[model samples]
Target chain A: MGRRSWVGAGLGAALVGAVGVGLLVAPAGASAAPPLPPVSPEDLVSSVMTAQRGPFAGEVEVDNALGLPAVPGVPQLADGTSTVRVWSGGEDRGRVAIPSPDGERTLVSDGTTRWAYDSRDRTATRAPAGDHGGPPEGQQQDPTAAATQAIATLRQTSTVAVDGTAEVAGRAVYQLVLTPQPTERTLLREVRVAVDAETRQPLQLTVLAQGQGEPALRVGFSEITYGPQDPSLFTFTPPPGTTVRDAPARDGEQRPEGDRPRSTVGDGWDTVVIGQAPQPGDGRPRDGQDGQDQRPEGAPDLSALGQPVSGPWGSGRVITTAVATVIVTDDGRIAAGAVPQQVLTEALAR
Target chain B: MTTVSASAPPASRASTRSVAPLGRLAAAEIRWVLRRPRTLVLLGLLALVPIALGVGIALTGGPGDGDGPGLVAAVAGNGLVLPIAALGLALSLLLPLTVATAAADALAGEAAHGTLRGLLLAPVGRVRLVVMKAAGVLTVAVLAVLVVAVVGVLTGLVVVGGPSGTMITLSGTTLGLGEALGRVALVAGWTIVQLLAIAAVALAVSAFTEHPLVVLAAVLGGLIVFGVLAAVPSLEWLQPLLLTSGWTAGADALRDPLPLDGLASSTGRALVYVVLGAAVTVWQMRRRDG
Candidate 1:
């Protein structure tokens, strides 16, 4: 009877030990590390914008796991804008540009726009924001709406934690970890931000996708400048003589007023064509003139004329005829100069 | 009336009757295999390898940080190390022993036991006897591979988990889980074929030597030389010709969009080696005075 009681006690002890082990290893309740501190959206936006002022005009480096080394001159900014110019040896490969913002705008301004230009294609395309909603060309996500969406994401997905102190770019900084919620699949799982403690400027940002089996994406800034930027940097003017096309309306419905151009050129210089320029030996005149005598004499001093010159026009001669020159200033108006009456009449007829 | 039978049965009928002795010889060979303690020990060691590896992975962080639990376990238990060790165990140790144990004792063991003269007096053909002994040796080799595979996979599943899957990172594309596991299975199957080829080579070597130790040394020395040559990067082009190279063919499956170049070439070489080795063994056995 005594031996039986001893056996029962041993069995009870083993059961308790097994339960303890199960509790230790089980994945449940593993999230008890501590609830991340709450972060206000306004503070995040202000902190990000403040860090946007920097002299970031030099070569930037980016590395990935595809056996490719750090590619140089990949420009990045604090507002999440990036511009990468691809190159091979000394020749330019192409350009990829992305502009990501932290919050939506209050007024209905133009949306966040991103673009990429393939020199080979001779075409530039504007990409949609948020997700891969559409091709690179067309109308983009509304700037205000995009900002609101980003703010909502920050509120819903990100759990902010102040992760102690660190040094970045020779400045003492506070390290912050922004952990994404479980449902945010495409967004990075964690982002480490090193902010200059005193200035509240973000010095470094690292994006980590926990399940990607890849290393973290890191970007660092060096020479930083603060203050207002040149307003012209934000303005865009289309090239002269290039036709503008109305972007396709979203949802196949007519765009609202001021959302699209009224008229569009269906076929124009912007159409991408594949080929090389005709060489001089191709039996065509170098200047597209019928004969050598029709060519301008004394080479026309084409370098000095600079009248929107393209190609080998008047390369070897100058033929002085009734000349008319019309100059279009930066403002939308025409200015005429030194035009014969007959030449002006002809120009007006065209 | 029996004395009046003018001639013995025709040669063809006599040969057919002689094949009956082959069955008895094979049965005896099976008993010899069962008696060897080394065979049991080798199999036990093979079974233990996957368990040890799985335990190690579960305790450590596993192969890398981003790797899932299933992938960490698979890579640690089966993908890289186990297959290589299986090849070495089969080719360098187990296979040569099988050949030497069976072939060296084909006639010599009988002579030592005073049964050679008695067996000679039976209506058994020498060639038929030699073929039976080779069959027995090959059966042992095939059994060894199966045992190792079964125990390794089962223990691996218990300690790590199921053949859940693997993740291969390539060109920024992540493959799905099912596709990755299918590739791992293919790698494991290829490893088995390579091991069988090693057995064939050992069987051929054993046909020439009566001393089991001599047969072991010859077969093991060939493996060592091939291993050294494989290590020399300058001679990498010759890797496809070496039998041991096929052992590493599984590594192709680990790569995203599996690299067919090396795996296909090595498998072809292993097949060639197996066929040639078998042919040579049969030829040698046919001419030997058994």
Candidate 2:
């Protein structure tokens, strides 16, 4: 080759070789950043709990299998299930929604007023701050409240102990088992809670009702994130001419947040509650039922059709649903729960 | 060598007149550069870079994170990322050698062949001739890189096919075909910039030397010194100014929204070296007798 050609070819080779060295030094694209170190179970649980107390958003699912048939008037319990989505921006602002097959029932509360919106009917309900239908503002950001309540109740009635470890919602957690003592003849078999070791939050909960092998009820967060939420979710305005109902301030012990005014016969799995049946207009309609019952549309009905049956529980008509068995005693009392009739008879005997 | 104190000729007219002749010169230069058996061997070696990487990854069925992650790690995930991966693979040593050798022989080889004077007799200006040589070298260099990248993409698709076009970034964001293609172009562009730096430096070194091997050694020595300076913790302040500094910043283009800080710094440093090296070469060529 001529001198000039040699120069050209050499320069060409140089360009390729030099660039290969310069550019190829960097590694390829990817996600192999170092992972976080594992923390102890107690630390993880506390961390998750602390994390939940901050702003966060997530979805929770409820599954039930007590072999009860569909109830007449109740919307959620009749179907024996519910799904809830929660969003919060720390205390004083949050929203919890029940996304049903019919539509969505969302209750949002700031520190002041609580508002409920039904996307299906386009009706909005507003209540004074203290009387809000949803959880109070103080507990708004505490998404672990449901699990906390269950854990607290189990602790009071059963043996609370850590079994092992589990992974839930992509975080490592300690598996907490709550078993009723042999002395405690509660209807529940056991309760298992998956507590996050990092945040001390309950990531999952499983309730095994008496007589059932698999979990009778499972409730936990499916997706969860911790951060500030859009503030607008906490505020609600009745969308144009939607029917808006204003509720009085903190209506008497009529709330249905599993905190209703009721009396319990015992504690633990065998625990039975004797209370006035859920009535219409007290809380959101069950199952978002379109009022197929004899009662007015969108109203909660305490009564269900049943033939008379005499039992040691004192002659009552028994009504069974997918999740609960209700026995309306002849004496104006309704004993509705997942417990067997014999247990109710025993409660009556007590 | 002739020194002209007169004002330079009109650039537009000169550029226009130079186009056809420049094209022919470029073609002739490309023919001579590309046809050589040694050149073919070098190109074949360059093409092997991505193939070898792909085969290694394929054989391992992709290691957990595939050695060091980020650019090269894409082999473990998506084959579409292979082009970018190959570019990254080529950059460390293969690229430096290729550019250094080409630049080393640009002028020194002509002098050694005793054809420097005859080569200068062409009607083209000294600057124009230099520009043509640079263009030819750039064309060949870019082609070499393209061959490797394209071959990598094809081989990856063939051997370790993944989701057609989607690639996950280091930050875990997913990109579609369009964006990945853009990223490939950007990586190529960044490699070219760094390679241009080496080319100019080698050319300048060539102007001062009569042996191509010496020119190559100069570039090698220069890069080695720069690498050492960059490695020293106490001298880290000079890293951003080194010709070889932060060349890997181009990989950031694969990240969505494209981080600009590193890319800007690297390109700026490369540009400075390019201008400085080109100036020195021009001075040497203009002053030294043939």
Candidate 3:
């Protein structure tokens, strides 16, 4: 009996120890980078631009360190890690589903018609494709779209390099780094794009601000699978009893009275977009269904945030985050960008 | 206890009883556990929570217009979310607490009553006794979760879904009646696994102490500590080892084209705890003498 008990005790101890060891080692193995052949930065950039985007589906995770306070009417760029699923069937067909605790917000486009549905409110908005606004602001979620846009805007004003080969979403990728030129006045230090080695598609985009150790923003695929997705995934019909609304034709023929026209000042990394905060219930497209955005009365008090400041641009508040800053003027003209206070003042002065 | 020894014809026959059939032992143990007054009361109380939640939302017009948790706020019009949300809320503490109570009673309560000595002296071997105790705890966990889920769905359908049983998914798609029930069942099954892991740990703790309250305190206290550790961002390296870290992953069932990463990882973590807890209980039982 003594020997049998001893054997039983030993086996139990061994099994528990094995679990601890396995947990520790599994992460280290998943993150270890595999060896790959070197490629030039120029060649990698060209390859990304020319690569054909075929059918594929994946889950993308966004990590935001922007430190922006929750403001009414402003899209809350997720404060922590949020996951969204993306599917692309080449050309104009695509779908992105953003699932929240209460319900999901899904945007689907099948080449010609686009549908935006919010399950929380049971509302669906249908619009013809090719609207100038694209998904309301801050809804362009696919990593490939974000990466390509960053390259197009910053390539001429920055130095590009291929730092090394790394793995993203379990796929080998070339790390393409873009650093703003010495003459450029911007808060951003560099942007890194991870391009899949075999497919030449961008799988992740990381943006870093000056002096910050952590990336200011990271939009990347957490898990991805290449090849054909269910064709039915890209189509949408509002479930019965949904309050369906047809989006008024926004063909640049007429601007709604509540629409606050926006204009940009300066160029490249320091550009500031200025626009008036639209009135409550102005029917300006809402990209999210957060509680803060649903207030039936007066706009979310912008006065509750940031320190008050007066400049030649006029008296207002300047709200700052890790990656961007916004100044809401007393007269309601708001200017925002990734530039410093001095640059914003200069742009406002102009 | 006296009848077992009285029935033994000879000393050699006692050796044969040591190898008790596992099925019979489990059946007897589960019956004993279910008959306990405390277990019945705890499960009955659990059934009331979802009904209260559903009625409150129906009368109050849904948690004061969405200031509440998303799932609770969504319960106004969508009846299917009621069961999932109730489980999610209960999973944090109440469900684990209920399972812990049964596990504590499995060995500690019996030992405190002096009945454990009779079972220990009986022909049942130490390993088989430990297995039977674990089975009793398992039965309690399964019944506690099913009672909550079943009551929640009935309350939800009656209060919110009404005659048009159609409900929307988090992905903005609608579900048929069959599909909605399937999702609720999936959530219930996943919750059972999590509760089982918690029960296994409570049983191990139960074996070490004669006072049932100590087992309850130790298991619940450890869970609270795991919650504190998981909240600290710098302690992320230690989060993976905590049993509470994956409790919220059960919400994955509510998603359309469900993402299994969180749910799968959480299940794997719970399985590890289950094995470790069972092993410790077996090892402790072998050393214990009547």
Which candidate comes out best when scored by DockQ?
3
lDDT by residue for model 3 over B111-150, one digit each (tens)?
9999999988988888899989888888888888898899
Q: Residues B1-290, candidate 2, lDDT per residue (tens digit)?
A: 13333435566566777545677887787787777676677778988887887888777866542134545544554676787778776776677778777776678888888777676776667776677667656766787778777887777777666666566543234567778777777788888887888888888888887899998788778878988998886885566567776766756665433556467767766766676677667656755557
lDDT of 2 at B15: 72
| Candidate 3 CAPRI assessment class | acceptable
Could you give candidate 3's per-residue lDDT for residues A1-350 as a string of tens digits? Answer: 68786686768667675865487337524576668789877567667766778889999989888887754322327477788899998878999988765567889898899998876666789998887456534234444465556556667778878888889999999998988887778889999999999999999999999899999999999888999988888888787656899977774334653355888997777888888865556655444434443576435544557888889879888888887888877787788998887787778778
Going through the candidates in order, the fraction of native interface contacts each one reproduces equals 0.00, 0.00, 0.38
**Of 1 and 3, which scores higher on lDDT?**
3
lDDT of 1 at A319: 16
> What does the i-RMS of model 2 come to?
18.8
Interface DockQ of each model: 0.01, 0.01, 0.38
lDDT for A150 (candidate 3): 53
Model 3 TM-score is 0.83
What range of 10 consecutive residues in model 2 chain B has the weakest lDDT sum? B1-10
Instruction: Kindly report, for each predicted structure in the order presented, the TM-score of its chain A compared with the true chain A.
Output: 0.31, 0.66, 0.78
- How many Å off is the CA of A194 in candidate 1? 50
